[model samples]
Target chain A: MALKGWKELPIGGVIDEPGKSREFKTGNWRVLRPVVNLDKCTHCMLCWLYCPDMAIEITVNEKGKPQMLGFNYDYCKGCGLCADVCPVHVIDMKPETEFLKD
Target chain B: MLTNIDLKKAQAVTGAEAVANAMRQIEPHVVAAYPITPQTPIVEYFAKFVADGVVRTEMIPVESEHSAMSAVVGAASAGARAMTATSANGLALMHEIVYIAASLRLPIVMPVVNRALSGPINIHCDHSDAMAERDSGWIQLYAESNQEAYDLTILAVKLAENENVRLPVMVNLDGFIISHGVEPVEFLPDEKVKEFIGELKPVYPLLDTEHPVTYGPLDLYDYYFEHKRQQIEAMRYARKVFPKVAEEFYAISGRKYDFVEPYRMEDAEYVMVALGSTNSTIKYVVDWMREEGHKVGLLKIWMFRPFPKEQVQQYLNGRKAVVVLDRSTSFGAEAPLYEAVKSALYEASARPQMGSYVYGLGGRDILPEHIRQAFEDAIEGNLLADEQRYLGLRE
Candidate 1:
């Protein structure tokens, strides 16, 4: 969409549409990416609970048990909070360039 | 389209009471205020009205001026008609949020009882407090009398809430001089005032669940500049809309108003420019000087924020000399009002020789003799080499 002129913007810096923060794509600012080792993961969910950006996604298995699905890189800012809180040491902060090379 | 058939009778009251009465009639959704000298009575009166159920307003007696302004911003952003009152140091305390309120384009109406900014702890009438926030992007309307104070308070709400001018407004009255002095003020009936202001239509209220909106967000270089440009556009729009709003107000109250009130300017060679209550003294001096065969006049500024440059030039051009009286000093530079008047006539083909007189700082008394001396000095070209003079100061 073409950006409106300053005169066309709403008063008070109001964003008329709701839930549009998803469009910001803060992941572009990330220098590092979170990498998870599923086999070593204890399923403690501490990383999921402690993720500041809410970037950690949790999934369920066929037996109806919750499982960690690693970070959602689209919105993750790579702050390393999830890795810091992972007791099992399954999550590692890797440079985005290294991950892309692999 | 208003007729006097529903106009209410006049009452004797102080400027503070007049503003409080106007607020009660407007019945805004929220008024979050913290009191300081001179302005305290305004909020106190309004709070009593709220308590007595004379008006059903959510009166938040906030602990500090910062919180008071913050609450007003939040309420206004939520799409409610919100207001507050303050004076002097109280205004200084709320300086940060005051800028935010205007930048957010919230139509909050604040009654600023003008008092001297203190170091020696003076609590008296001066323009220092209002002058401090002159560049905060709020529309400023200075009242010269209690009647104008009452009238402008009502008009400020309409001006601020105008869709084209969605900016906060500060209705300024001189501390103690107008705020505490009792004068006769005619009021529009409650229904007429209600009808005149009409309904406040918020563009994108935060309370609207289905269409949620962000109030204030972090906008850096790319968007911040554009937003500020939008605010400038709104201020320009206000300059155009103010007269029309005043016209509507006149229809109701039979009292006419303008951005600049030029008294006896036509055929006058020397004129003095001033703002706030000092205009009354200048006008009196002008009358006395005229009777003595002096071609003198007074130009009173009612609207200061948008700085009606064109109107100023129109009245001041071709004059022999113009003297600007400022109640506050700019310290190392020219006084604020003087700077504005000089710049307004800088490029005029027939620019007048202008001088500045800084007077009434820290509530120093400005007698009619001081005004007479200012006019005489300007007429005789006895102004300081720098063209700035101090009035009523002991050597």
Candidate 2:
């Protein structure tokens, strides 16, 4: 991103626009990524409710009912509280190295 | 519009109560402060105002000194006109947040009652506490009396909230001496204070739902320095913007102040520089020595943080002798005010033979005879740059 001069930038590093936090990706900081199996998943939304960063993405399927789509890797600091909160025990925390090795 | 039929009456109150009265008059949106000695009375008095329904300020009785500052920072960020008060240990505890308050450009008006920083635990008057945060980017105004304390607290709010100078301001009054001692302080009426304070008009406040802004955001190496550069520029702008705010304050109260106040220095051959409540005692010495035909005067540092460089140089330049007194010792340093005075006169055409005195620490009584000795030393050329003297300490 192009940087603004001190005078050009707003005072106190306050991001003036909403959702500007999305620009700064935190997924890189994640060592453990939460992965879920859609086959056994009950879509209880507990993991969605428990995610600290709001990294769990929710959307509507063909039936138009809200369903847990997947993790929004753009954020998702990989705290693993989301996987722990899932009652069905289908979600798992995997090492980032597994994906990087691919 | 100055309202109320009865106003401008000087009330007999201590510096703490006077400041609380000013806070009452300003009626800020929030006051998040923890109680501490000397400074506790300020919040207590203001709390009374809150209880009586005199003002509708959201007074947050914070758990700790750190939380007190944090609460104000949060409130200020949310577009509320916020203020806080603290003393020695309390001010020290809020150290981390103090810098954040300035860097974040929150216009928090805090009145600090100057007390001795603990070291074996002593609670009395000294500049040690406020001096610790001298470089914290807040504009520090030291008051010599209750009236100035009252007036400066009001001026600080106006100066801090200025668009060009969105920095926190610390108004200092001497602990016990000024904080507890009663003096007649002229106060502005509530409507007049409201008119003068006007509105807070915070920049991109979090409370504004339409304009969502993220405060205290993370900026890495790419932009951290530049953000600090903005704080630097804002402080420099405050030096220029202060007089305009003081001008507005003067119009209502007929009281005006400057960075440095020179008392009887017009034709003086010997002069001394000092700050806080000590100036009141120093002035008495200035008056006494004037009668004896020795041309002696005092340059009281009204504003400490900015250091009032030019005015200090302008006042002390070409004088035969200059004595700088600090209530707080820098431990190994040459002392904060003394070092500043010397640096100010570094580029001047002529320099005065200087003397540095570290006096009145931990609330030691500064006697006239002791003040007389400093001036007499200046007269006799006994003062040396390297040899720093201590008043009231038998060594």
Strongest candidate by TM-score: 1
Q: Please list the residue runs of candidate 2 whose C-alpha ends up more than 4 Å from where it truly belongs after superposition.
A: A25-102, B1-8
Model 2 Cα displacement at B88 (Å)? 0.4
What tens-digit string does per-residue lDDT give for candidate 1 at B1-395? Answer: 01222325667889999999999999999999998999989998999999999998999989999999999999988889999999999999999999999999999999999999978798998899999999999999999988899889999999999988999999999999999998778777899999999999987878888887887888876578888998999999999999999999989888888999988988899999999999988888999999999999989999999999999999999998999999998879899999999999987889888888989988889999999998898789776525678899988
- TM-score between candidate 1 and the true structure: 0.91
What lDDT does candidate 1 reach at residue A8? 79
lDDT by residue for model 2 (B141-170), tens: 999888888889989989999999999999
Tens-place lDDT digits, model 2, residues A1-102 = 566899899998888888766677778899998999988888788998888888989987788777888899988989999888889888899999999966
Instruction: Provide DockQ values for all models, in the order shown.
Output: 0.61, 0.65
Every prediction: chain A TM-score: 0.81, 0.79
Instruction: Quickly count the clashes in candidate 1.
Output: 0
Clashing pairs in 1: none
Model 1 lDDT, residue B177, Cα: 92
Model 2 chain B: weakest 10-residue lDDT segment is B1-10
